[model samples]
Target: MSPNSTDAMKTNLGEAGAHLKNAATDAGSAIKNAAHVAGDELRMGRSAVKADLADSALAGIAALEEGGGAAREQMDQLMDKGRDLIDSAADLIRERPIASFGAAFAAGWIIAKLARSGDR
Candidate 1:
């Protein structure tokens, strides 16, 4: 081969090698950037999930507190009603001792009968 042709071939091969090296570097850089983007997206998604879970927990606690307040109010009302009933019973017993005693005896007898029947 002529010396000029051999030199030209060498130059072409060198240029091709440089281009391949540049392409490989670019591909490596692109891969690294993609990994960083993927990692950032995952972090953001995890933070959003955590925030949603915290909100749901807060809502659950509020619901429980509201339900507990309602139950407490209902219990207070039931206690008041029971007190009133006991006061009425006491007044009735004081006004009619004999009637109350007779009624109590009848209630006891009926309860005993019901118990015996249930056992059978």
Candidate 2:
């Protein structure tokens, strides 16, 4: 080959090699940046999941507390109703002693039978 042609060919090969090296370096840097961004996104997603769980737990606790309050109020109302029933029965017994006595005996007999059956 001519000396000039050989030199030109050598220069072209060297330029091609440099371009390939630069491309490899840029590819490596891009891969590293992508990995870092993915890691940060994963951590943020985990934090959001944890926060959502905590909020759900708090909401469940609040619902349980509200249910307990309603139960307590119902119990208070039942006790008041029981007190009224007793007062009315007492008034009836005072007005009619003989009839009240007979009714009380019948109720006692029925209660005794229920207790005996429950024991079985």
Q: Which ten residues in a row have the lowest lDDT in candidate 1?
A: 1-10
**Quick one: best lDDT, which candidate?**
1
- How close to the true structure is residue 106 of candidate 1, measured as C-alpha lDDT? 100
Q: Write the per-residue lDDT of candidate 1 for residues 26-101, one digit (tens) a residue.
A: 9999999999999999999999999999999999999999999999999999999999999999999999999999
- Candidate 1, residue 27: how far the Cα is off, in Å: 0.9
Per-residue error for 68 in candidate 2, Å, reads: 2.5
What residue pairs are clashing in model 2?
none
Question: What are the lDDT figures for the candidates, one per model?
Answer: 0.99, 0.98
Off by over 4 Å in 2: 1-16, 109-120
Regions of candidate 1 where Cα sits further than 4 Å from its true position: 1-14, 84-100, 110-120
Let me know the TM-score candidate 1 reaches against the reference structure: 0.62
Tens-digit per-residue lDDT, 1-120, candidate 2: 567988999999999999999999999999999999999999999999999999999999999999999999999999999999999999999999999999999999999999999999
